[model samples]
Target: MAERRVFITGTAGFIGFHLARLLLAEGFRVHGYDGMTDYYDVRLKQRRHAMLAQSESFTATEARLEDMDTLQRTVEAFRPDIIVHLAAQAGVRYSLEQPRTYIEANIVGTFNVMECARAVPVQHLLMASTSSVYGANEEMPFRETDKADTPLTIYAASKKATEAMGHSYAHIYGLPTTLFRFFTVYGPWGRPDMALFKFTRGILEGTPIDIYNHGDMWRDFTYVDDLVRGIRLLIDAVPPLPEARGGSVPGANVPGDSLSPAAPFRIVNIGNSDRVRLLDFVDAIEAEIGRKAIRNYLPMQAGDVPATWADASLIHALTGFRPATPFREGVARFVAWYRDYYGR
Candidate 1:
């Protein structure tokens, strides 16, 4: 559509880095904003940014989302027509240790982004949410309409708040916003805190990989490329106004899969929809490395869910595509990239 200018937060982060590169490759001028926090490895984030910097259409600004003044200046300078809010204090386990970090980065930080979007007004505003919000729910597949009242961790709670805040802003200002709830996203350039990355690192280092819940956990692992493709398709699928605000008749009683029906805002799960066991995931990595992992089976960690399965029917209905990358292929690609990147 008209050479769109895209502004994204957390470019140094895994999904953000991949999304930035994807957009740049598609001829979109990309503006990356990141705080470069030392939560994991600053060098890794910098490396992701460095790679994006090679693209002529890519420009980056180092700024924290909590710093509204600086963020405002950066946003104004970029003048993005579409803004993706991916920067946040990530990690469910880390949230238990540092609750305030989640507040400042996710809650307050997201508010600042909404304020900016309120001022500039974009064609579509997309933000990241996690499947963790399904907290305490034992349902097979999570739907957006599911009651997300019970958040096990501060990180999930903050994201839930952001969704509510975004809905309010959209209702009041007529802003078209799309919320993407990602399920176990993994691939090259993935965050070090994620399971796949950790498992690979430990296996390569001859260290034991912690198998939580005795390796019974299941996840809808989505490859980075597939997740980004879903996003690219949704970039143009701006939320349509609900047909009936006051009353509903057809399909009103149906309840499953996450899709908002009230405002010009919706939440869709971008995932493979294939739930693979945790042990199987580790096995795939081990096979890719040609070495078995030293496993340390343990009880499930606090704020950790036993399983996550994405009902991506809405995503397919909207985008006409679903994440088709099998775990073996996606994991192998990550392992190859990981080995090359670490020179192992």
Candidate 2:
């Protein structure tokens, strides 16, 4: 068999960086496309791209997802067997302030990717969604089949929109599509905007860290490597069209699978399946940093959910894997990287 080629968007972003590295290590020739926006820190994005550049099999294109021509050209030249779309203007609070950015990047940008994929027709198209789509739901653990109709923020809405668009493309064009909803992913090379990164920085600098909802929140904080491992495994678990399965569901052997009946599409949740309290997460950071943070308790901000937990059995059923990294161990690994990277 020939080596597989993968084209991954947002290769300079947190999850994308890790996924591309994992694929490259496994001998996959990868083409990475990233805008390298200054949403958080362009330097961090540059550093991630630089590290991946060390691999001879990794090639990167620096361009925005809204640039349809560039995206289409890059995908055409790469001729990837699989395409993983992860680029977006991400953040719940930021979405409230800049909803148009989310529309352009998440909506229009995703449309551009789908168009390119349609033209080239990859074997599988896997895109990233979010647990935030389960907004306003009081369910203990969100399943892929759960009705995610109440998206609190534009960020979640934009992701939901992409999922809908992906389904249509799969139904109309027979594209094999998988939309994976991720939980709170944290580890080394994490986005500075995320809670873990902000808290670690504030603790190290002896500054105040905002504990939202008075530290009452709970999250299924998945480790970055573990999250990417699930992704790597799911790459091979492509959804089959209903017709291809003789009008039977592909994963009917396993219960609670989110395989679509009308299209070759599925939605899977990639999470740790263990919810950790915000205060306990802080404790893990304090232990790793050897210092206590100045905690600033505040009301829950708008467009924020009190908790997010994922029922990852669907992903496990399909790929025979689930994210299992504990929050403490993942935090320790992230803090060690923080200290070394910043020369603390």
The model with the greatest TM-score is 2
What residue pairs are clashing in model 2?
Answer: none
Once fitted onto the true fold, the runs of candidate 2 whose alpha carbons sit more than 4 angstroms away are 246-252
lDDT of 1 at 278: 89
Predict model 1's lDDT versus the native. Answer: 0.88
Model 2 per-residue lDDT tens digits across residues 11-105:
99999999999999999999999999999989999999999999999999999998988888899999999999998899899999999999999
lDDT of 1 by residue, 32-126 (tens): 99999999999999999999999999999998998999989888888899999999999999999999999999999999998998788788899
lDDT score for residue 274 of model 1: 86
User: How far off is model 1, as Cα RMSD?
Assistant: 2.9
* Model 2: per-residue Cα lDDT at residue 92: 93
lDDT scores of the candidates, listed in order: 0.88, 0.93
For candidate 1, report its TM-score. Answer: 0.94
lDDT of model 2, residue 287: 93
Candidate 1 displacement at residue 310 in angstroms: 0.4
